[model samples]
Target: MTIAAPTADFLVLPPRPDSTADLLAASARQRGMAVELLSGPVLPDRLRHATGAHLRGGPVFAGAVAEDLDLVLLEPDDDWLTRLPYEYTHRDITLTTLGEARWSRTPMFVKPPRDKSLTACVYADGSRLPGDADHPADTPVLVSEIVTFLVEYRLFVLDGTVHAASRYATHGRLDPAPLDACPHRAAVLDFAAGLLDTCGDSLPSAVVVDVGLASDADRGTEHWAVVEANMAWFSTSYAADPDRVLDVVLRAAGPRDRLAVRDRAFVRPHAAVG
Candidate 1:
């Protein structure tokens, strides 16, 4: 049986008129997709009459928006630490269930497995978490070995290929790394390819993965590693090709039940979730 291609009815409410969200909508229209203009920053309630609405950093997968369009907001999983490669091998990073982390005694870098519901920082002591005041005492978090990264890049992946990439930071700061003339671009791409290959069919079909390169004097090489993954919807499109990125962002952020209903999961706040 021949299946017909689904019509993409994109709803765009850019943070600003000329923002990245607007760029995405423009690209979609150029591709012959139907766009529903929200006029301005409106509430999710307005989505009641719409279908396939796209919002940047839109919360949760339920409610009026969920009823009209199957919204899917992609975030990291608890086992995300195990999904990639090299844990405690060259870098000391581990995932602990909320129930088990309370037993730790060492000072560690504590962060949520997915969203930033709680601030990510080096807690002087693990037994007493800073997020205790804000997050649930039992929410799962990534306890990582803190390392200084020389460069950080965000890659938008679709299928198995990286559609758009941008270097967003350097030396733990907000300096933009130029993709056009980066000296380490080749090495970075190669390392990222290795990590993506490791993920194979494990990762979401459309998602954003952040990778970083740290200097290792002993190995005389720039060690590349997975920093984290983010929802394509909420992530910033640094210097990447906007049109290509919007393509993946649409897949990663739109109504979930539309096409790939199996991957749909609500973004909730356990201790304030994604």
Candidate 2:
């Protein structure tokens, strides 16, 4: 039997040129799918016929988009996800003093909670902590216990389905083939599911789950850990198979019948009215 086409209205927003969002749209079009490209900010005109939108930039307007659209794809909701209890080994410091404690037995990594653009600082020892004068901003810092990781994995969950999964090298490069054979696969799915259940409403319909594995020294076994999670729309396919990722978008829409319509106005704020 021939498969029917999907009728879902897809809004593809490429905030910048040569961005991954544009690449995804190109792939979708190749499959005979209809996708509208929003070249600049998501103004009212751009969002008028949009039922689902894939966003690449900041969440400054997510709340507004979410108010009208069925699905607004972006990164996981930072406010909601950060509250969950995870094995985040962190250090506390006052604004006046920059100090580090050898509390974590293992090597640790430091990253900003809010500013993901900042490169993560890996410290083999605690003495390398930056002083208050050198701190980027007052945003909280995370000091995570480092594990001897073997491989990293990126799993894409769309509308409650594990649509795409890919493994990556230590340096964040994508692996072409699926790592279903990897033992860490199950654990990664479990983590993703739990995350979705907790923040389902707030989370974008599509998101990427990042899982890491540590090679155990004594047993020579790999222990799975949740590395981090990012918005699927913004996260680079890295070394992911672009074709496979595009397939997920196609499947989500199914055979087109009636187009989905979102009734609301999305306004892009101006710094000052002319």
Candidate 3:
């Protein structure tokens, strides 16, 4: 039996040169695939013809598209997209002085909530915090519990299958290696599965799950905890096998005649962010 190729439509920001969305769209076209490129804001006119979207615009624009589209791809699953369990994020709040984060227990990390493309400030116990919030550019600061980890892993799931999985350095540095032999492999997979279960059918077409090994000083046993979640389209493969990651992305975009089904309910009417 002959298989039908998947149709892809991308809703991107304007002047899309040297952007992730552009690169993905180009890749799809290079393969002689059916792809449509739409620019500007996400309006009904633009999304009406799209079956899938690679979203890389601002939160306002991306959220709008997500509300109307069946399958929207995103990068860095941040607060603007959705909230994670037990993760408390305070935007617009600057830590003028670090007087020890009560919730963090140990040293903590402070960084931008959105763009994490650069190094973050690490605070050890009793270290003097930055003089003021102004010290770290103007980006909002995020103070998170400092987690001592053995290994870090990234899990990408597409259409219910573990598409790409890899291990990385635990010190917020990117280094890629296949995780088939990692001891915490099963735990990371389970964590990703659980997240998908929670999302149910409302999950995005491409999602990234970050898992890390947390130190258990008392028990002397390691525990796997969720570090972060991101949208697969905007996230770089980092240390992951580029070929594998790219293949998974292309397959999720509707390759091999398989159409990725998504939830119509996931699309909601646009609402302004408070």
Instruction: Name the top TM-score candidate.
Output: 1
lDDT of 3 by residue, 1-274 (tens): 5333335543344334334455555555665645444454545463444565544444445455545454433333234223544421111223422333322435666654444433466666434445454444433445665556667887776665567788876556666677786776777777667766765344545556667777767678766666665545445555455545655554332211234345232222235210
Q: lDDT of model 2 at residue 11?
A: 40
Candidate 2 residue-wise lDDT, 1-274, digit = tens: 5333225545445345345556677776776656654444444543544444433334433333433443423334334334544542112211111243333344567665333533566676655655455463444555655555567877776666567787776644445446576666687677667656764555445556666766657776765655665655445665455656665443322222322222011112222100
Per-candidate Cα RMSD to the true structure, in Å, reads 5.9, 8.7, 8.6
Q: Write the per-residue lDDT of candidate 1 for residues 221-265, one digit (tens) a residue.
A: 777788777767767787788888887877766664554644544
The global Cα lDDT (0 to 1) of model 3 is 0.51
lDDT, candidate 2, at 65? 45
lDDT, model 3, position 228: 60
lDDT of 2: 0.50
Which pairs, if any, clash in model 2? 5-255, 5-256, 6-255, 6-256, 7-256, 75-231, 174-239
- Give candidate 1 misplaced runs (Cα > 4 Å): 1-8, 14-19, 25-46, 60-64, 87-89, 97-105, 131-133, 217-221, 261-274
Off by over 4 Å in 2: 1-8, 15-19, 30-53, 56-74, 77-107, 113-115, 124-136, 171-176, 180-205, 218-221, 239-274
Query: Which scores greater on lDDT, model 2 or model 3?
Result: 3
Sliding window of 10 residues with minimal summed lDDT for model 3: 87-96
Candidate 1: minimum summed lDDT over ten consecutive residues — where?
58-67
